[model samples]
Target: MIVTRFAPSPTGRLHLGHAYSAILAHDFARRQGGRFLLRIEDIDGTRSRPEHVKTIIADLAWLGLSWDGDVVHQSQRLSAYAGALDRLREMGLLYRCYCTRAEIAAASLSAPHGAEPIYPGTCRVLTRQNAERPHCWRLDMARATAIAGPLTWQDHGRTIVADPLTAGDVVLARKDAPASYHLAVTVDDAWQGVTDVVRGQDLFAATHVHRLLQALLGLPTPAYHHHRLLTGPDGVRLAKRHGAPALAALREGGSNGLALATELRVGRVPIGATDT
Candidate 1:
């Protein structure tokens, strides 16, 4: 059976963009007689809050959406993530990165503003061992790509070539967190038997790295649907950081959630809101 998931970090409440993505994934699963799962991406221990997690569950419930099975929390699966990292390390695809954020920024001064600076492989060749120093594990993209060869993944219905190098060598495990977003999500999706990945276009670029991870880990690749994102009048995408209103606020304000969901399904966004 087809399976999809709506995974949200518990750092903030569910905004309109989040709701739209959830609704699309849920509707697609239901229409195909499949299962829709909910996952709490609380890997970032410093930022994740229990109160926010509670509100996230409440918000989704208030939106008139139901998820199949119990909710999956990323925090509870540290061992699984560790195992993946160990496997990659054994394959000589992982290396320790000791560069600080400021140092990386200084090295990436030539990169465009707001663009993610590709790591210059500063730590890729370090042979000295510093157990006392803090470090994160990064994937050697060049070496990994050499082993996996060319890769591709399904986006909507098109087969797009995987360009993991575009993001440079991504961190698979961080010193502050047991697993990076890229590592945890890829492992979780495969473990959950997720067949389809329905999310926003903003994440379309990250899929490239995910495809390479799948190939290296011998995990199955799922079909992907990069749906349009919801934005406000200013054309900026709706996000918690951007001050997008929470779904719970709309629910408590006497708004009809079922009606709102209906309008969303038809691509009708709220006043001052647009989909892009």
Candidate 2:
């Protein structure tokens, strides 16, 4: 059976963009008589609010979408993530990264303007470490890629070659969180037996890293559908940081959620929404 999931972080309330993604996953599963799972990516304990999780469930239900079985929370799956990290560590594909954000930014100055900062692998060669010093774990990208060999994954109908090197050596475990987004999401999807991953196009690049992780960890690679993002009046994608209105706000303000969901299904977004 086809199994898809909508995994959202509980750092903020669900907005229209979230509703669109959730509805797409839910509808796709229902159409195929598959299971739609809901997962709360709450690994970031510092920022993940329990209240936001409740609101997220409420917002999805308000939009007339439902999921099968119980909702999975990443916070409750630390041991699994740890096991994945341990396997990588045993294979010598993991290293401790002690560079701070500011230091990493300075090192990545030669990168193209407006591009994401790529780590220069300063810690990859570190022969000594202070047990007292706090450090995050980074994947030895070169070694990992060498071991995994060439890899590819299905995106929509296209077979995309995995290029995790573009992301440099990514952090797998951090001091603030037990597992990074790349590590947790990749592990969780496999553990949940997700056959399809329906998310926004913003994460399309991250799939490269996920593909590599799946190969290294001997997990299944799910089909991916990176749908276009919904934009606001300013053309910026709808996000909490972009000041997009929350679904709860719209729902409480007398907007008919069912009607909104129906319109979204036909690509008729709300006011100020622009297709990307």
Candidate 3:
């Protein structure tokens, strides 16, 4: 059976862009008679809020999207992420790096595009004691890619590809956090049986890291569809940072589900067309 999920970070309210993605996933699963799941990506504890989580669920329901199964929250699955990290460490596929943000920024001055401030393998040679210094855990790209070999996965119904070397050394666990986006996302997708992923094009570049993790962890790789992100009138991506209008705000302004569906191009009728 085809299984899909709409995982969203609860750092802010759901906007029209979120609705577009969620509806797409729901419709895809519904059309295929499959399952649609919801995952709350709240691993970034510092920025995630309970109110935002509540609002996200409510907003999706208001937009007429229903998901199957209990929602999976990433914060509650730290042990699973830690176990995956441990597996990588045991295989000698992870290293510890103590490089601070300032150090990386200084080194990035002359780095090439998509390769800014690469890890430089700073701690790849560290002894056990040296590795114990205040540092984050990074995946050894050379070792991981060697094991995974040439990596490729499906994206937007196309074959998307990645080379671990060009992707560079990825941080798996920060000093202050147990799991990064790469590790957490891979684990959650497998655990939830998500066979397909429908997300924004902005994340397309990060697929390299995700493919590496999936291969290293021996998890099934899912098909991906990276749709065009909804942009504002200014041509910039809609986001909480720029104060884009949220779905909740629009609903409060008396906009109904039909209006939202029309704006997203999912409604039966056109936006400004009148009924006969």
Candidate 4:
């Protein structure tokens, strides 16, 4: 049976963009007589909140989206993450990254993309036996790409070539958080036997790295369906970081979820519509 998942972090409230992503996964699964699952990506212990978790569940239910099986939380799967990390480390594809966020940004100032910078391999030369400060583990992109060999993943009925090297050496596990975002999601999707990955097109690039991880870890690759992201009046994508309001707020304010859901499904949300 086709299985898909909506994995949301409990860092903030679920907004219209989140609703669209979840609805896409749930509706697709239902249409195929398959299963739709929910996964709480709470691996970021510092930002993830229990109250946000409760609010996420309420918001999805309000939109009439029901997920199969108990909701899986990343915080509860540290051992699995550790095991994956260990496997990568054993293959010499993992390395310690000692650069702070500021340091990385400073080095990537001339990088092609502004603000969101790809990590320059600075601490990549440092070995595990090196005398240094607290560090995080990063996937050795160059070595990892070479090891994984040529790769590609199917997306929306198209064969897309994987170019994980551009993502740079991504963090696998941090000192504060046992597992990084990329590692956990890749591992969990395989663990849950997810057949399809449906989410925003914003994450289309990250699929390259995910495909590499799947190959390196000997996990099954899932077909990806990257849908259009819900945007605001300014044509900007809705983001929790940009202070997008929670769907629960709309529901509490007597907003019609069924109507909002229909609008989203038809891709015709009203201007300044707060119902969803």
Clashes of each: 0, 0, 0, 0
Candidate 2, lDDT over the whole model: 0.91
Model 3 C-alpha lDDT per residue in residues 105-160, reported as the tens digit of each score: 67656567755567667667767646557888898898788888888898766776
Cα lDDT tens digits for candidate 4, 1-276: 999999999998898889988999999899999999999999898999999999999999888889999999999999999999999999998888888989999888656764468898888875555537788999999999998999989899999999998898998899789998889999999999999999999999889999999999999999999999887777777777766667987888888888888888876665556424
Q: Give lDDT tens digits, candidate 2, residues 190-260.
A: 99999999999999999999999999999999999999998766667888777778898887777888988
The regions of model 4 sitting more than 4 angstroms off are 127-132, 271-276
Off by over 4 Å in 2: 110-115, 272-276
What lDDT does each candidate get?
A: 0.90, 0.91, 0.81, 0.89
CA lDDT for candidate 3 = 0.81
TM-score of 4: 0.95
**Cα error of candidate 4 at position 179, Å:** 0.9
Q: Which candidate comes out best when scored by lDDT?
A: 2
Candidate 3 runs further than 4 Å off: 110-117, 128-132, 266-276
Output the better candidate (1/3) by lDDT.
Answer: 1
